[model samples]
Target chain A: MNYRIWEGKSGDSLNSENQKCTSRCGMTSSRPGMARRSFLRGTAAGIGGMAAMAAALSPLRELEAGAFNSVEEMLQKHYKEMTPDDMERALARIRRQVEQRYHVRPEIRDIKPVEGVEFAYALNLSRCIGCRKCVHACVAENNQSREPEIQYIRVLEMPRGTLNIEQGNHHYDRPTVPDDKHFYLPVQCHQCANPPCVKVCPVEATWKEPDGIVVVDYDWCIGCRYCEAACPYWARRFNFATPKIPKGALNPNMAYLSNRPRPRGVMEKCHFCLHRTRQGLMPACEEVCPTGARKFGNVLDPRSPVSEILRTKRVFVLKEDAGTLPRFFYYFDERYPRNTGGEAPTWTGPEEFPHG
Target chain B: MGMILAGLSAIMPNLDSSRQNEFDGAQPGLEELAHPHAEPVDPHIPGGALWAMVGFAALAFYFVSQPALPEMPLAATPVVQASEIAPGKRRDPIKEPPRIRVGAFTYGCNECHSLFLSAPERQGPLAQHTHIKLDHGLNARCFNCHDRFDREKLVLRDGSLIGYDQVPTLCSQCHGTTFRDWERGMHGKDLGSWDLSSPRHVRLECHECHDPHAPAYPPIVPLPAPNTMRMGTPVHLAHEHKPEAGNPLAPWWMHVAGGDGAAHGPGDAHEQTTHHTDGKTESAPSTHKEGGGQ
Candidate 1:
């Protein structure tokens, strides 16, 4: 049997009629312990009957049972090896799952990845208060794994006294904000001009898009986690476990720039809520900011608020001292008198964000 | 006969004086001696009574004028430090001037015309009714609002002048931004709506909605109703292509566009760009992560 034919035919080989049988066989191979018993529910008269009987009588059942030890290994394939057929199959499988998972059948399409559009991002950090609204928003926008261990927006709480964000951490479980000892400075993917993650990838699995967003081709990623390690901001996340977002919480509005619901064993990072931004709307984070701190706009447009702030404010990029040319920049209100002098500055630094 | 008459009158006067002296001797110093030093001819009055009457009149005048004296000293003292009195100083006593406190018989001239400690809410009574209301009625007299008393300046014999134009400064004591906004023409009712040529504009008093003392407004809340549906058509039907096999009736664009072809499957790809299948002809996809999300 030609393995290349199987690989080539992966996407489109199965029709709606054979989809269940093919998926069952596909799932059986990845599981070693499961009995390779393929359930053939169809009429025996079809497919010339003899081959069907041979397929039924032979050890194909046992072979099918052992097909999938892990669902991700069964579902995901390298993008380079993928053909029109492989993509069609993936689309079909996705549709089947969508119908099974949600009683509603959603039409699935094989999105041809776009080319040449260079993505860039600019964050008005001066406007960011550590609301953690972005964190929940990201989770909902991206159907990210809801496991407590996984978080897409790693909001780093940097206290007032410390300028060093590395020592600041998000793992402290006590509550949202620690106390008076700290003011929160949430740090996420800076989407650096020169990304260390891109350089470290063994496979060309991830590449920086024209718009300045670094996206991973999930099919190409081997889950080696080299990108996660190389990232200075610790922005990359490796999916070691299966993904599950409550059906009720799923954000139906999704876009490829923001990445669709990803299965396990692929690394994920902040895609800047691509689905909404690409559609000409503000990110959920910007929408939810009560203080109007997180401003987003086209940096190219001088009229845009983001560009205006850059032009007017004495803004400094994080670790600018390192020359990363981080798109995220923070500005301090120089006129703001420190509470140390007279009394505390009236702003208790957002009463809710008690964490450092 | 003549010698006998004279001797009888003289003897009679001598006999009366001797009797008076014998009566005074009984009480010694307590009794007045009938001598030439105490001689008074008129039984009714003395001519020196006019001088005594003048002295008594002067004493009575002083007692009557005591009420009119100013309680404070005639000279103005320094407010910060009384001893270091500055020249041209206004002797403004910090004390609660009458009618300035909870109650006063007559409204103080200064109340509504100037800024005062009697919070802005207290100013309303003196403004409309010429009388302080019952809640503010008992203690909050007229001077509570009209706090600029002209008594010291002696500007008004009756002290009825309410200093106009000084109203803004008084109103700005608390409704500062609103006053500033109104002054800058950013807010307030526009009187120059018809005549744009003139910059002249008038703003209503700050007391219109808010009492200056507790000057605040409800927090910002966007109109809670969901945004009106996009003003245009709800669904436009467009089918891009004719089918090859599956359902002859079902267009390829419907399958390609992913269900709901009525919503996305525009009939002509060239005319409508909503669901273009060709990536080349389709609008370029954005590279940047949609939101600057981390």
Candidate 2:
């Protein structure tokens, strides 16, 4: 296995077996007794300093020098054991890689682990038009695995001319639209004000903050999926296997709010596009909306657009009797046209019945 | 002569006083008193009996303006439980019993009706028609005849009533059209369902179905559809029965027949009694020992 002795020797003098062995382990057969002092000295110094010098001068593992450094770093910290400093360094390195690869100077924001904010979300079902844009956008933004394709958002195609939530299906195929007999309702996490997910978390790894945002510390999570079940809205999802994202396609503009490169066996959900919203910008869905249905603003600010809509418009929260006090509100229209594809008959009456 | 002069002076002053009394005592002209009944009297009487009567009348009028105690009943009925009810028992169909006289409705029809005085059953004469011709004899009362209603003003405990412009929710108690619609979220008004440009929706009345007195599910459809009540079925409950993911304890109940794990069951949990690969019928677990827990 020792190929250091042959490292300086002519290639013709060395056997192919020894060459292969040297290449595999990057170890060379040399006078170990003579190099013992030098190796110890190198070890006393940091590994990176040695790596930098090795990359330039060492003939051994020149092609693998970069890969080895990264692999070594990856093995150093099990995600759970990583410290805040380690995360920052890891994020910085990722940033460099993404900038080099994609030519995208991503606005990477290290979301401060808010001390007391619980993050949640609510979809205005009355506003959704069964557009699959949110679904596709989530797939592209989250960098989901191929095969049985995955995305966080599932724009359910609800029955038209009816507001029956039961008739909606998320397992819709291509050409996804509201069923002719059903009205389109896009559903996502209700992000309940009282999150059962936080209550059921075995380790206080996931918690709600003062800002009403619920978050999970990925490193602290044991992947029990207890939070997922405790959630009535089915907002939480668990990563059963290691996530695969093509390095080139990875979104470098990651925020703790919107998209953070998640580890395996952890739970995740919509952060209300926090990465964008916290920066005083609209969410990706609102930015990309075709119907101008989605509205996002602070409910506390009375003058804000969301608050104004709530004040003047006949807005109602879903399942208010449940006492969840959801922030998302909906405005019903009376003159909405019926999509008559399904068997459910549209009953036309006085101009008072609201279209859902 | 001196005595006569002193008497004349005293008489002159007495004469002026007498003249003033005569003028005041004389019957007042029409210009002084507008009417003879407007008799002059002492102005210092405190609240007299007449004043007390007027104050009492004013107080009574204010009290009369507001209706006596809320006429609508506030008690909630014990939730009707379906799970405990036996399947085949033909319970009486929920209907408001007929009220012929003062105490005809004894079976708590007012539990749902709330307001007692103008029960929907007393609107029309039931003596002339049969139960079949009268649509189960439901159209007998005041609420039965009156259709639209408003919840803000309810029928009073006394005979006095207010006109309800919007539909009364009385129909919802029996018809369940609006209740079913509400469960599916079709009946009620909300902004989220409508376009903002034209934003007006209907306010449905409960009397839209039941004759308020009879309060029956309108026999509008030919037959009620069969109930399909499967738990965890996609229609009723989708993706809800999934076992906790990656739980090792899950594998115990799902082990294959004869302890062979290869021929697995579907959906991450299996119920297999025989191994098909080798056509071996696995010996059943002793029903007596395993089935009954000590």
Candidate 3:
């Protein structure tokens, strides 16, 4: 009770005694009393530090309040670890967020992989006309950013004599395509069985689904961009700024792992339109290809079109040297380009197949 | 060399006499290094000379960094008008085949063709059917596909009459591989769903994508090329490069080789093959014409 008076009387003596005691007890400070001037200086320095911190963080005040993640979202479990209840809560929160931003109640769902189905895609090289309808149609269906322009598919116009992709042109703006001297090669995420992107993910934000789709949980991503570097096909795209999609162009059919609106700084790629595929519908790209060049089906089903192609045609995957084991395949039918006169007499008439 | 050194020594009083003596003695080819008639180096450069040089360099850099004065915009190359390019048409599933109009009434083919017994062979361009340009290569004769007896039906190679919906059966006579591929849902467009369990899947018929008369897919204008990250210029702005720069759109080999001659021009082969195939088809009796020609 009288320690202040006693400490004043024995300040210099107690200072040395307390320093020894505090050093033995592992306490930091051994000062018996604070000087009026030192206390004022310390108070001023502490206030200045607080002011500096406030000024440093002032830019955050301009951030869109709606874009900020909720406490629940920040603390959400990884995609693989989430229980059904956790997923439902997440979906509900997403619905609220989407409605608030877009003024449209989206039919967002957590679509899961179907059992006993492994999706594979095949493209017929002979028929592809290099018309980039699939690219635009995918953008419309996927709700990708239009201003900064994120395209999942890149249709390369490859020269007839060589198959090197580096030699192909991505900026071909010919009025009409198939250009007579070139063939089209549209590339997207191959949904590799041995996905490098998934392997290189610092957080387990991205992983291969049971059905062979590589998906990213946007909420859990730390935006390190390691997976983008790992992809050989240049498939993954990073949102450098807040994605700006036209309000009317927003596709309301959202899926948690596939076509949902991605926040800025997450990695995204083609997920084989898992939102539609899981529900027994064709991917937007496959459905929109005017030439019918794109083919997608369950490879496990022998009767599927993709299975038939793999069984009959000499199909090859891109970047086979990378050992990606891509589910996407490209094949050529033994026929000349349509309307071009070099039609191979493989199965034209009785002259070729006399038994017929 | 002696005159230049004397001039340099007069201008640069700070020049050491020992260094001048060493230069004179050590270098025997000093006359070659000094241009015989050139002026000596001026040690009394202007006080503002360094600033002048710096200013000149800054000016040069500014000009270099500036985008070349937007060249007098040339009259733009006349690209195929966007309107001229064909927008590819998809067949409506419920739409019916063509019917002739006769005085405000649409009549079926049988209604007119059955009224007259026309010549078996085409005599000339018919005045009545001027619109039908028979350009199906060697299969140009009307009787080749249309049933002469039953004007409403198409005649297969076996002379069996088939409805318009059975065009694939007739086409399969020549395009066997395509027909088989179409049947397996590999060649032509399949709509709705990929799952066989879904009833919404529909396979387009042969005539759905191709005109039976032409049987060739027409060239169509492609959608706009991507301009992702604003890295690419618009198609109209693509004319910035000179034509002599080789085509920016051309294959990398063309740029390296500097001409189209480096590669086999497909157009040449295409023309030759067209002539050869047409000749072989016209002279059907000559089974070995293609082999003999080769």
Candidate 4:
């Protein structure tokens, strides 16, 4: 039985049979020879596997070393796990990277959420002129890729007489906006309370902060694009190729979870300008809106603009049927479209057009 | 001197003939100019030489008489203050109140209006304030907003005068709903900070965004449309769906029939029913109906 076992293990039946009597049960002299033969065979298989692995990774050699992440970045912890010291180190590394690439030493910080502050956005549908200024302002603020343009906002020109978004045209090219026959509706990340994008993330690379901003950990994301697919608003943008931005156009103010220059194959979206908003500044889109259509503020305080809007205005969210419960809302003012020949009352004199 | 004189003399005959041809009105024939021998030679300190000397003298006199270029001043490098360069600090977008330019000087509305007496009745088409197009949808009278006696102040419904900064209060008399929204920072633009506790919070005045005389917003040229569609096609060209066809994403009722040259879908009957219902409701929010008198 011992002799048969030794022969089976060695796969050398004829030789094993010749030495079986000595090697198997009692003799120790034949043991060294059998061990040497098995060790040589194992080494050959191990070498073959290593060669295959090296060949498989050969394409990575073409990647530019400077553009790729350093050893420190590759091993950096997730945003939630990083301590203050780790964050400082990460920010320093980011600053160095940005300075080296964009020639601007960005004031990058890992801005923490303020206590008791929850940000929400409200847009006036009646006032939005379909100008697309908000969209461009967002791109400039977020340091989005220019050529392959990753804009957070998509303004749709919906024909009058319907609230249906499907009936909206995203690519409306008109001489002027707010066409007599059409109204504009701009769509962006709703920052949902029950964000499906966060739920579907396999690695938990994205999460909602205490302040209600859904942010992505660009370093931790594996670029699987599950979150992009799960998002109903199509807000998440996947960097298909290396993002290109002019050095002069890059916004020097950056944050780890918000508008930092993202590497290729990472997911990014509107963090509601968390870098600026956390510092109590208005979002870029809201600031650039010419018609005063965009409004953003803390929803926690009763006196906050968003809170007032919610309390007073008949606000509605896009894709409400999806049960997203978005922080962003859309509302309308009570007024006729200007210059529409609506039967405005006639004014005889100052008596009729009273001081009021 | 001799060589110079000889060169000037050689060029003189042609110049004289050309000048005479231009100014004297008796033009020389091309054949006479081409064949110099066809014309008699007259050389009395030729008219061309005199003119050339005059031109040279004028050129020399102009250069000598001109003032020397002032020493180029060093580029005025702006001295940036520390507070100006401080991080997170932004300059205010509106630095000063609106002023009326009268002749060479800019003056506040009260400066000139204070000198004149208040008109008893609504005056005819204004001669001075002609630029103020009163097209604010029936709220057209000047005294409707301006105080009759106090030119600097805005008049309210209660016949009380308020300062220029209080335009919102004056606007609120008629635009109650909009003013209510503006009070909460919902209607007009709010800058600086969303946090109420922050010292930087600023709500813009009504007159900042809208013209007082013509409250209705004017049409402005929109920014260029997005050109980042898939397959590298521009947005406008990529989706060239005809406007008459209505939006492709539109519901069957919203879509115009006979677009794309195809027969109507099975929802044709349902489309007609919904279309009639939709016509009555319209797309406007219910608030427009409730708050109608704006």
- Tens digits of per-residue lDDT, candidate 2, A217-239, equal 65467799998777655566676
Error of 3 at A336 (Å): 3.4
lDDT of 4 at A135: 80
Which runs of model 1 end up more than 4 angstroms from their true locations? A1-93, A101-127, A167-181, A321-323, A337-356, B1-294
Q: lDDT tens string, model 3, A1-356?
A: 11122255556665565455435631222234442323332333334334434544554654676778899998889988999999999999999888888888999999999999999999999999988888888887888877567888888776686777655556566656667877889999999999999999988999999999999999998899999889888888888667777757688999999888888889899999999999999998888888889999999999889998999889998889999899999998886555453542322333221111
Q: List, residue by residue over B1-294, the lDDT tens digit for candidate 2.
A: 234324433343344344443332122222123333444321111223224334544554444454433332112212212222211111223233343444655433334345533323332346533553333332223333332242224343342344444333333444464355433323332222121122332222344333344443321111111011110111111111222122223344432232243322232221112222456444222111110000
Worst 10-residue lDDT window, candidate 3 chain B: B285-294
The A-chain TM-scores of all the candidates are 0.64, 0.62, 0.80, 0.80
Q: Chain A TM-score of model 1 versus the true structure?
A: 0.64
DockQ of each: 0.00, 0.00, 0.12, 0.11
CAPRI grade of model 1: incorrect
- Given candidate 1, what's the lDDT at residue A201? 90
* Residue A346 miss distance in model 4 (angstroms): 4.4
**For residues A177-267, what per-residue lDDT tens digits would candidate 4 score against the true structure?**
6677778888888899999999999999999999999999999999999998888787888986678886587889999999999998899
User: What are the TM-scores, per candidate, against the unseen true structure?
Assistant: 0.42, 0.39, 0.68, 0.66
Candidate number that wins on lDDT, 2 or 3: 3
lDDT string for model 1 (A296-339, tens) is 54565554445655766677767665555666666554332122
Where does model 4 exceed 4 Å of error?
A1-62, A336-356, B1-124, B230-294
Give model 3's share of reference contacts.
Answer: 0.29
